[model samples]
Target: MYSQLWCRTGLLGLLWLISAGFMSAQTPARTELTVTAMHPAADSPLRLGANFSLRIHYDSPAAFRLRIQGERQGTTIPGITHASPRYGPGAGEAIAWLAFDHLAQLDRILLVAEDAATGHVLTSLALPLTLTWSADAPPGAPAPVWVQELNQHAQLAITREMQAPADGGDDFWVNLFLQAVFLTVPGYIILQIALPWWTRDRWRKAAWAPLIVTVPMFLFVVFASTAGGSNLAPIWLLLVCPPACFYLVFLALFFWLKQKRA
Candidate 1:
């Protein structure tokens, strides 16, 4: 009798396992997106027309859309929004921004991520927040240059969101090309100083080489003396390159014209 009961129990357990496996195999996988952190402490007050960045990590099916919205004591704030025209991510790292035009006792901020193709919201993350006007600052304080630029950029993002084409007016390739030019143009210009050496006969005096090289060396000295000293971006970083690498292209045609005239 005891053996019979034990066999029945084993048979019932095996059947249940088979049914559970069948159900799980038929179910689809779920999507996941998780926010790890945000900037500025709760006590830190945000300024009007300022921008803030959020650090995010997500596992999205495809490239996702991000937007920012705000609330005060659970009440939705109007005329304020955020967008990502270039920085939107398809997978892995993500980004968001905040922009506002007026002061309010903001109790929280909401972040919404969506499927760019279908407009389906992937996830929404909300955090308690506070915004205020500076007590020490005078009324109607003028924004700093950086702040003004950031706000203008945010406004541009908004306009693009409304007016941009289905292709999203993405400029990733263009930006990549420009950045490559900035980094490599200097190297190419320095190569030009060696042209006379390569073209002249062995016995001929390439008199132009020494003088032309001296100017770039002097410019390098000036740049090295002041490299990484400023908080803002500089025209030429302190390096072993001529300052003309950037504007040298503008003078290319004139050099050709002079050669033609000669």
Candidate 2:
């Protein structure tokens, strides 16, 4: 009877292992992908070109193959060479590298991915691509300089026009700051006022307000420095400053009250 019981236990363990393997095999696979042009968004209508990267997300481990089908013109492209999977075992993402330069026309690209084992088409997406030149970076040669020094300066200007700002600075930061201050401050003040106990303790609580604002202000300055006056999103942080300033005043008053209480 003991031998029979031992045999039954071993059989049950093997059956459990087999069931786990079957579940692993049948689990549904899911993935998400974001394909975006790597090129600057504001390149001029004239000198515009196309560059893109495909980010793929998925679950389960499996090999994938990809293809890019598009029209040919005055464009240069480096083909897909390898697959890079990100995230973890159950969920991950893959990025495919692609490059296109000096294209003067509109084009449509269909990106397709397939399962390597069963030859099943796992996913396919179509991307519409277009090119434009820098609004400030004019087409053709720049006008002649008045002096040799002007010519030297012109060369630096020309090179800068070719590059795109990686940091979000141009105008986004400015407007964002404006909006944040105009909208967020009043709301915060009203909320604070509604709390009678908090309002009564404002003097004690206020000192921390400036401390909180100080860090975000430092971050905004750092963000602006890197953006180089190109993108505008950094401006949104300005909206936080007004309320922060108010809180600073409140903090000073709170400190004064604390001294009196002492």
Candidate whose TM-score is highest: 1
lDDT of 1 by residue, 108-195 (tens): 7787776676565667778776755343423443434444454466567667766654444356566566577577545545644544
Q: Estimate each model's TM-score.
A: 0.42, 0.28
- The weakest ten consecutive residues by lDDT in model 1 span 231-240
lDDT string, candidate 2, 1-262, tens digits = 9999999999999999999999988986653345532223322244333233344445545555455544435243443233322222345444443433443333554566666544455667766665432334345333222223333443554455444343447656766765656765454455444433344455536444454665666567667757654234344545565666566556556655876798
Model 1: clashing residue pairs?
A: 63-90
Candidate 2 weakest lDDT stretch, 10 residues: 79-88
In model 1, the runs with Cα more than 4 Å from the true position are 1-11, 25-33, 61-63, 85-91, 133-262
Please state the error at residue 132 of candidate 1 in Å.
3.0
